[model samples]
Structures are given as C-alpha cells and as structure tokens.
Target: MMHTSVGWHVEMEFREDDQHTRAVAMVRLPDGSEVRAHGHASRHQTDVNQPRVGEEIAAARALNELAMQLLTKAHGEIDQASGRTSHPIHV
Candidate 1:
C-alpha cells in the first residue's frame, strides 16, 4: 500500500491603471509547478469609476481562469495515467 499527501498555495495581485485594473493569480503546486492567469477590467466612459468594483471583477476573472487551468492539468494527468485519450473536461 502507498499513501501520499499534496498541498498547493494560491496568490493574487491587483494593479490599478489610469483606466483599467489588472489582476494576476498564481497557483503553486507541491511539485514546484506554478500556474498563472491574468484578468483586466477597463472603466467605461459612462460607468462609475469604482476601484473596488474593478478590483473585484478582475480578481474574479483571474480566479476563474486559474480554476480552468487547474482542471485542464488534472484532466491531462488523468489521461496520461489511463493511457487513453478522453474527451476534454469542462468545468
């Protein structure tokens, strides 16, 4: 019998520009693999200039992209282990 434990860490950073907000999200895996995703939100001419709102939107988008990346990685691993190509997994 074999047993293993794994852990990962997630970090996010938001940057504000003159008319846009950018967010970067990173995931660090136990095997030293790092996955990164980015998102951006632009202020519209008629929309309110809310820093918090931009940050929230950008962060959410970045996290969503990160989730998809992680899922894809897992699916690829599963395919390799199974030794057969399977349909792409959707989140």
Candidate 2:
C-alpha cells in the first residue's frame, strides 16, 4: 500500500482502572487535512478474566462507533470535493 492511501491509523489502549479501553483513529485526507475519531469502552468488573461477553459487546460497539465516525468524516470530505449530498433524487 502506498503512503497516500494509508491515511488512517487505529490505536487501541486498555486502561488499568475499571477495565476501561480507548480507541482512537486518525486520518489524513488528500488535501493534507487531518481528522480524528475517539471511542471509550469500559467494563464493570475488576478482574482480568478474559473480558466477559457483555464487556466484549461494549468494546465492539465502541470500536464500531469509532469506525463509522471516521468513515462518515472521510465520506463527507469526498462528497464535498465531488459536490454531492446525502439526499436522494426524486422521480
């Protein structure tokens, strides 16, 4: 992959307190503009036990939100460049 297309990077970090996890995504557009997405996940339990099902679900949701945000931002940038909108045509 070329450096140009590789505009986004994903980072996931787990905190030591309250099973908190954070995911940050950063992207650079073609116009040399940068955007960021942030998501935080947390579990209630204090133990390190393989992340319970609910915890996994929460983490997944957080990551999904972060991904969607980043993609939406990128799509917006592209749409602006191409002069497009989210509205559909009426027949």
In terms of lDDT, which candidate is strongest?
1
TM-score of 2: 0.46
For model 2, what is the C-alpha lDDT against the true structure?
Answer: 0.56
Enumerate residue pairs that collide in model 2. none
Please provide, for model 2 over 1-91, each residue's C-alpha lDDT reduced to its tens digit, 9 standing for 90 to 100. 6555444554443333456655554555567766555556666576554444434554565567666765677677778998986543222
Q: In model 1, which runs have C-alpha deviations exceeding 4 angstroms? A: 1-7
Q: What is candidate 1's local distance difference test score?
A: 0.89
What TM-score does each of the candidates earn? 0.84, 0.46
lDDT of 2 at 69: 67
RMSD (CA, Å), each prediction = 2.4, 6.1
lDDT of 2 at 22: 56
User: What clash count does candidate 1 reach?
Assistant: 0
